[model samples]
Target: MKREIENKSKKKVIIKRQDECLRPSIPQFSVFEIIRATNGKLIAGSDDLSVSGVSTDTRTLSRGNLFIAIRGKNFDGHNFINQAIVKGAQAIIVESDFRFDASQGASRINKDNLSLKDCASVSFIRTDDAIGALCNLAAFHRRRFKIPVVGITGSCGKTTTKEMVADVLSAKFNVLKNKGTFNNSIGVSHTLLGLNKEVDIALVEMGTSNFGEIKRLAEIVAPSIGIITNVGYSHLEFFKTIDSICNEKYDLVKNLKHPFIAILNGDDMRLRKKAKTSKDLNLFTFGLKKTCDFTATNIECARGVLEFSLNKKHRFKINVLGRQNAYNVLAAISCGVIFGLNYKDIKNKLSAFIMPSTRISLKKIRGYHVIDDTYNSNPLSLEYAIQTLSEFDTKGKKVFVMGDMLELGKRSVMLHREIAKKIIKSGIDTLITVGPLSHHAADAIKTKKRSNLKVYSCGCTLEARGILLNLLRDDDLVLVKGSRGMRMEEIIEDL
Candidate 1:
């Protein structure tokens, strides 16, 4: 009788498995949740629906993902909606009044004899604006998690500082950080949507070229901790002035509610002033100065490593080749301190932290020392790079290869001339420049009539590369830097 009962139980379990195989798994975000988050109108599909993920690009859209069609200056996402659906997109969020042409058959979509039921099977939600709706949805998704989100913004070192902060936090938490330069509205939204129960923290790096950009991003992220690396003369074409840049960058900290900490660069005069006057902010400061809450002293740079003492006691070393990184390290240390991390653990983590590529990356090429700072450039960053090159001990000539710093607007000439003065004063042996604005720097050097200085202004990267190849000597220390548009890294490749 017992053996008969066991056989009956096994049969019942097998029948339940067969029934489960007949049904499919549901997606993560229900159709109602999408409508609520984006305030979108459901054009088709059942109300009880869900998606496995959210995607902006049809090329990478996975099966059961919600495709958001975002329109940009050069490309329209509306044109790719059909393609997204064909690629197994579970649903699509688009602008209102978007027309669906069944004639254009997508990969999985059957064009001929398609009906409302076919459209309903692949859900469609329409909003007033697709990008705005994406931001709304990301904001809603972010609220689902209560983990700490750290937002970093500045004219320079935002990316590096973001990476450092994430590395420090990863010592105790599973960290999710903005990849590459994904700090804009669309990028931040995608990053926020990636947050799940597994992630312990999110380090978001925000970048902007115009006013009110940071404010919009801040509203979406609502960071628990805000960090401003430093306010510098970057994107002056839109910001117009350093004070304007400061106001724009400060929006991140300004948007945070009470019970949040503002990590500020105490070395920056504007931020220092703001820290002094800003009321009701839980502020923590970091810099090389003694006044900062987290300070670094006894700094040393040798063979592409930066060693410094934190708070005049704890010693730390980072394997990056820039003295300006000291400020970035100090900022990260402030964060670790705020989070109750011990000094020893913070030092251990920082020691293993490596800098992102193309930002002051030191390399050796064919018996020449190359400092590739070609990722991006601004007045402040250019000055720092120039100083770093000057400080390096070199056997052969010290060469400075530069390109124009774009988006400076009316200040382009003045800023380049200012950089020219620094180059001349730095005692660099050779200065090779490219681009039209960089001519201002070469001209500034020519006006000085320094017989010891060799200045060459090339019209393009090819010409610059030829000049560098002919001039480079064994053991020469060369620093290549420029704006992203200039593609300064190509010069290094050519050499």
Candidate 2:
């Protein structure tokens, strides 16, 4: 009887399965069919209909796949349209206003200085909203599956928190989590389209630099449980104010109907107030404060593991760094508790979770400790990373290598300078910075003349790598941090 049910379960996935021959409930449209669907006015006699799947890169283009030529700020996709075709792309999705062929009646410019109208295998579509079309396809694909989706967003800790929640849930559930930072409009759509029907739970992380991004992601996943980790100084450049960012972050809750579960930070006064106006929502909160539903008391961080007592009922231990991560662990525990997992089961599962790559990952290099927190950084996260490093209690001086915290908007100078003061207060002995904004931090640190603190200015990680290698000794501990664009991982490789 169990075997029969298991066999039936395996048939739901749209992707190719080993056991069953299912044609995937999700639609696989040919180039001609998509052109017909979109009413793409081709110049006649274009019959190419090959498609393997959707792709954004020319290098990854496979035979029978429709390559989406998205115009980026730096590069135009129309330039690579021919490359995609040469690499075996059956169809091409191009911008409506894009002039691939300057010649009259030509759909695209070819290497032979001719029109793409002559190519038998290439077909082009002019769409006003290519991203919208992708979103529509992804939404349609997700409707066939009955998966409990969990959407996570916040000013900080969204990725780490999402991973922690997914790991805990995966102990008893077949979980499908979004790949690293794949939480935006295109990223979320791809993640949804990648989902198979057999996945019991879908854990999706939604990130935003500007307004409405979370709304766009939430509409696709429609997560049953929405989690906002905390509101902090992130993406201030896009929104210009904390209130604006708060409003944007709350976009996830705004779209959901009544009877949705919201896991929020009760400690955040702004969020606590916002939770009040949200009607018909079952609100659950986890934090250090006593008012929280899943409060942690008697917290302790020892030997790279955080142990905290949950609501005075159970003591949970998670192998992660910092007190901030302890909050993430508690958030994951609350998720499990809502799903009907007992305290022991939640603790057992959470205990197995390790720190994610590029986010506070610890490695040993010739007996020296290297704390790699170079994943992504904001002012709030940088403080947490600094604090976590200080607690390591190393005999050698504690070192901090930071990079520019992007998207701070008008507050960039103030926040960067403030971090310099924080480095001194945190008792960091050495401070190194990369990029333009971070140079302000390095200057501020030097201005204070706290003889113990050695400040170094490197414009990029390559230059920073030279300083980092020279600073590290046999017993010294180092902490690396920066935003995604800073590429702090390169320095970690050198260390």
By TM-score, the best candidate is 1
Identify the runs in model 1 with alpha carbons over 4 angstroms from their true place.
Answer: 1-27, 101-118
Choose the strongest candidate by lDDT: 1
Error of 1 at 59 (Å): 1.6
Clashes of each: 1, 3
User: Model 1, residue 450: displacement in angstroms?
Assistant: 0.8
| TM-score of structure candidate 2 | 0.85
Question: For every candidate structure, what is the RMSD over all alpha carbons to the true structure, in angstroms?
Answer: 11.1, 6.2
- Model 2, position 191, has a per-residue lDDT of 80
The alpha-carbon root-mean-square deviation between model 1 and the true structure, to one decimal in Å, is: 11.1
Error of 1 at 189 (Å): 0.9
Residue 476 of model 1 has an lDDT of 94
Model 1, position 381: C-alpha lDDT score: 96
CA lDDT, candidate 1, residue 293 = 74
